[model samples]
Target: MEHDLPPVLSLDIGGTKLAAGVVTFDGLIHGWQITPTRREEGPRPVLARLFDLGRKAVAEAGLPEVAAVGISCGGPLDTATGVLECPPHLPGWIDVPVGPMASEAFGVPYALENDATAAALGEFRYGAGRGTSTMLYLTISTGVGGGSVIGGRLHRGAAGNGGELGHVMVRPGGRRCSCGRLGCLEAYASGTSIAERAREALAAGRASSLSAVELPTAEDVSLAAAAGDPLATEIWDETTWALGSALTDLVNAFEPELVVLGGGVTRSGAMLLDPVRAAVARDAMPPAARAARIEPARLGAGVGVVGAGAVAHDLLLSGKSDA
Candidate 1:
């Protein structure tokens, strides 16, 4: 899978940002642009701008040739069909044929992968899971999402969306989720959920330093927790509890050798990961727990781009080997 010398164009689509870059085999991003998605203007214009960004990234990288275009986005997106099936985070986006469009637009072969899945690959290829045969990557951001690699292969399911690890029920009938369910892992563990929980606590007249602020973020809560604010501590404890509980389930089910955590919420770093790791160790079935090692994603903000590029590279390499 080593490109050795060439770089691929990598694009990542998020609810808030549109990012594109040229990623080399060594996990370096040559020219990266982070732009607002402006999704309200709909998919067409956004895609046009995204394509333009890819072109700019290619030019800025000074690469002699572009091998391929790799794209990553949220799911339940169909990687096989290259169609986005109305991901809740992406409002008004319905069945957009991103792969074909990007292929045609870039005049090079293109590949699409779910953000979390690509992230798992990125981690496996260049991050915390470099030496592991089985790994899991979880992103706790606006929502909880994840993907896995098993036996050195991406564990994409029949519909290419197997690991909806975030949707797993953490507290049934608790908070409503973007997937229209209640008490999902996303509801309890996501940064949005963390902020909402804090806001609700404040609205309910909880005594805390956060009450001084008109609007508080998850980062504020984490900082408050670090400073020993009781209410913030309670919220942080619950966030860790839910993640630990759900991770116990994932560890038991997947038995991966390592678990890589990313996304905005992960900025809490050891504060967030430590408890989850302890929980899985204490709660998961014995053999599985013994097999898993929880850690941070090494790729940082470049994961999505590198991940998509990794997916494209793997697919292209597989095709070459097959032929």
Candidate 2:
């Protein structure tokens, strides 16, 4: 039966985008499709578009049929029941029954998982964590998310959402996070936070090159910093500092062999990685610091779709007969 398992359809829902692909058991993706979420349109329209995209991907992949469907999305969701429970990113989407909707649309069983949790499994089974027994994954994009594999098993925590790595407190009574926390890592280090910090600095009448760019983004800040802009440098350093501080705690707590960082913001590469690596090395417990290796994610733009596919692959192997 294992050898006879069929490739599955994978869908990833994000605040800003939606993606679909057909993924085989071998961890390869085919016919990937991407489109803007336009989340303001709400669940029904979005779900219809997502299903249409899945159909397009299947057709493009030239597959006669898929064994199952796997969906990955931001949470505060109930994975067991397949409900989307008011994720902060997708404003106004409360308790949408994504799993049943997806199953009905695709005419197949569906596996629903937290996006970050699924990504951890994706990286663990196919990417940077292939050889490691314990690994951690963080996605620092529009928001922050984390997942882990401990002792060679995916650790979904008690809530089944795995870990909320972004919520780690980095500053007491600091900037308000989307989670309503006063000082979460996401408040200071997420791509949104980075840009917000810059805009706030400019609003405070600080002089810097970033002011020249209208509505500057995190990428703009990194580019400005690379060009020797003092304001951008300050913001970038603070971002790295927050990441370093949080990563130190994670490395110490998880003691993973590898920590893979991904998502849009990591495109800055060394400018982002070098300082975080240094901070973890200098601050984490010696055993943890020496044992952990932090690296960028390998899946890049396709991670969500590939991760969703990985979830489906695991579901196929789970043998739970959930169809």
- Name the best candidate (by lDDT): 2
Q: Which stretches of candidate 1 lie over 4 Å from their true place?
A: 1-5, 320-323
* RMSD, one per candidate, in order: 1.7, 1.5
Worst lDDT run of 10 residues, candidate 2, spans 314-323
Q: Pick the candidate with the highest TM-score.
A: 2
lDDT per residue as tens, model 2, 253-307: 9899999999889999999999999999999999999999999998888788888
Model 2 vs. true fold: TM: 0.97
Q: Model 2 off-target regions past 4 Å?
A: 1-4
Whole-model lDDT for model 1 versus the true structure?
A: 0.88
Q: Provide the global lDDT of candidate 2 against the true structure.
A: 0.91
